[model samples]
Target: MTADPRRSRSARHAQPSAQRAAPAPRKEPITVGRIADAALEVVATEGYDALTIRRVAAVLGTGPSSLYAHIVNKDDIDDLLIGRLYAAIVLPEPDPAAWREQVTGVYTQIRDLYLEYPGVSRAALAMVPTNLETLRVGEGILAILLAGGVEPRTAGWARDALSLYVSAYALEQSLVRQRRRNQDQEWVLGDEELLDRFTALPAERFPQTRRHAAELISGTGHDRFAFALGLLLDNLRPASG
Candidate 1:
């Protein structure tokens, strides 16, 4: 044993090698899903207008060119963002008796989601509902309308109308919130202040506006949303046979 100095030295080196920990696993490669997640994070933190392909890529620690391999362009990212948000909605089975309630619930879900990521609804305005998830929502609403005996054409048109209303409502709310955040914007006033301003207009020429100032600022916290939704849904009568 004493004569084998080279073998002893090799054994000491091998012992440290065997005891050393293995290298850490590599980070997961970027995918479409990961890209979508990063985009949402950007929108959530910085608002939707701040979301760009380059920003998303920076969030994912990659270059914009790499994202192009997974997504087409900024419009493509908008589609993905809206599609991902729509995917979270839980569609209900059509019930003729409860169609109105079900439709209201779905629209409420969409409104809440849009509010969660301010300005995200702007992406929905120009979208054509081509994404599978977006189409799924449209299909769900159509089923409910048809179940309630609405004519096919009416149901289709009503779906579009309701979608437009929700998107516009969300976008308006987002814009108001943004304005409120900037205190320097005089137009961003409380309902009472707005009513006062309306009432302060010249009397003779602005009689109607002054008289109806309270009514003009009447609704609060989606009361207008509910009223408009009811107006749209309540008028949908089944065609006479």
Candidate 2:
């Protein structure tokens, strides 16, 4: 009679069956990911300014001492969250056929990502994207510039210029959105109120800005954004060799 392999295999595995079923002890019960997740929860509900180590610990059912075992400080948590978030972003491959479109598309994706995460947008200000995905974005942009015959230095600076533009614009929008939200309950001030305050200034004192009021605030906020993006893209065209 042929022996059943299943029975033989079962007998061999039976010796350490208890141990096999035993739950593995977690290496360092708390982890950086856990701390980051806790922090994200706090930010999602409470906003950026309200995100604190103490609050995160409370969510994790741990004390500050335990959290310290994982993260160094509140700033460390913020940095980790930003880097982790950056790593998850998916940027398109460099396309010489559509380099300008690729660059603008990346910026648009990043803007949408920051706004979706709300509180994290403020923390991202002036911070370099040292994470892999972000660095990849820079690398992809450089590759496209190289394909278009841009100098290495110009390509590098273009990366910085684009990142700065996107980050600064996002931060400003976040601030404006927050300000409006905070005032949502009260009687919202109208654009006329803002213009009235501006025009009330002595004519000679603020003539330039006040004189071009229509020009200054002519379009929807995004209208100016598209214009700024186009202006920057126009500067990237390589001069004839």
Candidate 3:
């Protein structure tokens, strides 16, 4: 299928050295937006650590010097990737009856967007939201929270709470998936192999843990996230008279 003319995914993932060859020759100059978009694509495919000035230029059909004329380095691409991430979120028009639904919808969209560009989630780890687009999102989110009856001071905290919630969780998921992928490939542990360690533990020393081991290991992450959200929303409830 042809790449979307409007939004490009190539930036989300850099071409793997094995899969990559020379980028197709472009007749003219490429804009910063185009470079940023491509960087997002490279991150999505190759991951954050894999992102580099060389790789981004490789995707753009240019060299490092050409890319540097636009982006100073890989960190610049990371900053740009976060900007693209901010673009994906859809904020609600703060309304009373619709506040809950609106906030819920916005959160769900954000969670799903992080899932799309897994690597971009790391950009939130130590990154600041200095970009204008990112600031606009914060403004919109704060408006939604304040309209939902949260106090102005409380609503301020909610902005950080919700934003961090999604990014932190997404980053954890990326780490978990990467770990599991490596484990599956290197040792190829069988189901029984993982179970054997637990089974071998001293029953007398850790009876309670053994009893609930299956529950602890097999519970879904989605259920945990929903539970956390449920608790947050409950805490954010307006005080009673």
Best by TM-score: 1
Best by lDDT: 1
RMSD of 3: 14.4
Instruction: Give the poorly placed runs of model 1, Cα more than 4 Å off.
Output: 1-25
The lDDT, on a scale of 0 to 1, for candidate 2 is: 0.73
For every model shown, the clashing-pair count is 0, 0, 13
Q: Can you write out model 3's per-residue Cα lDDT over 1-241, one digit (the tens) per residue?
A: 8889545667556566677577887666877887887787788788877778888888888788887777766666777777777787777789976666676677677777777766567776567666677777778877877777888777787767877887888778777677778855655444566566566689999887677666655646777766666667667865344
**lDDT (tens digit, per residue) of candidate 2 on 2-118:** 999999998887776446566886655678888877877787787777788888888888788998887767677777667656665566776677778877777787777676666
Worst 10 residues of 1 by lDDT: 11-20
Error of 3 at 119 (Å): 2.5
Q: Rate the local accuracy (lDDT) of all candidates.
A: 0.90, 0.73, 0.73
Q: Using lDDT as the measure, what is the rank order of every candidate, best first?
A: 1, 3, 2
**Model 2 ranges off by over 4 Å:** 1-28, 128-130, 184-189, 192-211, 237-241
Q: How close to the true structure is residue 168 of candidate 3, measured as C-alpha lDDT?
A: 84
Q: lDDT for model 1, on a 0 to 1 scale?
A: 0.90
TM per candidate: 0.87, 0.72, 0.73
Q: Runs in model 3 with CA error above 4 Å?
A: 1-26, 183-204, 237-241
